[model samples]
Target: MSAVPGTVQTVGLFAGQHVLAELEGVDPALLDDEPFLRRTLAEVLDLAGATVCDVISKQFEPQGVTVLALLSESHASVHTYPERGALFVDVFTCGTRAKPERAVELLTEALRPTSAQVQTINRGEAEAPADGHREGAS
Candidate 1:
């Protein structure tokens, strides 16, 4: 069946996760530690309405950390450094409208940051396929 005229196409629905945060007073050792990063990633995923399937983390000497989480519907991640008082995070959910920004909010609150900054961006919407291109391509 052909799509009704003027109706919005359902080729690929839009959704994504991305946020940058600045935090203060955290222990660099803890933040840059793999175990800590994994625990934090799990909590963040739960709070973001996503289920974490697996987590991989890497630590940089002195003070830097990165974590990647593979989730059921999507993924959530973070990079942290207590020495620099900074954290970068990303949460991506595909085909669902689950809001991952709340995770950032929770983290900001948990860290009890004296000063912080947050930036969020949606990553996949603009690339949604046009109706004509979607109709028979699938």
Candidate 2:
């Protein structure tokens, strides 16, 4: 049997997932606040259903704040550019325990951007051979 043209067959011990979101016309004031961003990250992680390990946030000299959340399944990060009124978010999880899209949605809602673009990619997908043969086949 053959798979459909648009379908994918995945076989792997781990599922590497990633979500990237680009937000435009966000509130610049919110982007510059370190405490707010930190808190927001925690909320986002919770929304994604991931186990939180540690969080580290830093504010730049002139402006902008970068927040990174270290999750037990993987990691989530956000970087803000206040001057351009834009922010970029990255969320990656190793297994099914986390939902990266939910995390992105939470961040977008908290930022309230005028326009947002989101992308989801399945990384490290392993597929079986097309010949229908296994390693132990005689």
Candidate 3:
């Protein structure tokens, strides 16, 4: 929605997908490998139709790893808990340039989680108020 001359746009116009995944029984060693995680994340981004601009991964001293991919459309990330044999993943992309679900799928394959729970959300779907009133405004 476009802003009128004197009124403000009370909602967003862009459409994006956000995928949240909870993984269990993952391989602890895989979650601690920075290089492997980075490469795998890059491949996942490519498979999801996202252009990867850059990637950052970190490994904790005791255990676990975190990988973040900065995509042209948006960002994808993974946080691992090797001790718990679990991980949390988030993939968000704007427009139709990428598929967040595909990314999560690939991650599930690479991590080999025994059980997984995924939640997908459609962002920026609210209709803008013609009267220029926000959602909570009376």
List per-prediction Cα lDDT, in the order shown: 0.70, 0.87, 0.88
- In angstroms, the error of model 2 at 32 is 0.4
Candidate numbers, best lDDT first, in rank order = 3, 2, 1
Q: Please, what are the lDDT tens digits per residue for candidate 2 over residues 50-76?
A: 888999999997999999999988899
Q: How far is each candidate from the true structure, as Cα RMSD in Å?
A: 7.6, 9.6, 5.6
lDDT of 3 by residue, 31-77 (tens): 77889989999998899899899999888988889999998888999
What lDDT does model 3 reach? 0.88
TM-score computed on alpha carbons, candidate 2: 0.81
Candidate 3 worst ten-residue window by lDDT: 4-13
In what order do the candidates fall by TM-score, top score first?
2, 3, 1
For model 2, the stretches where C-alpha displacement exceeds 4 angstroms are 1-12, 126-138
Q: Report how far residue 103 has shifted in candidate 3, in Å.
A: 0.8
lDDT of 1 by residue, 23-126 (tens): 66665666766886788768866876777789888888766888888977677777886677667666667655455677777766666667777777666654
Return the lDDT, model 2, position 116: 98
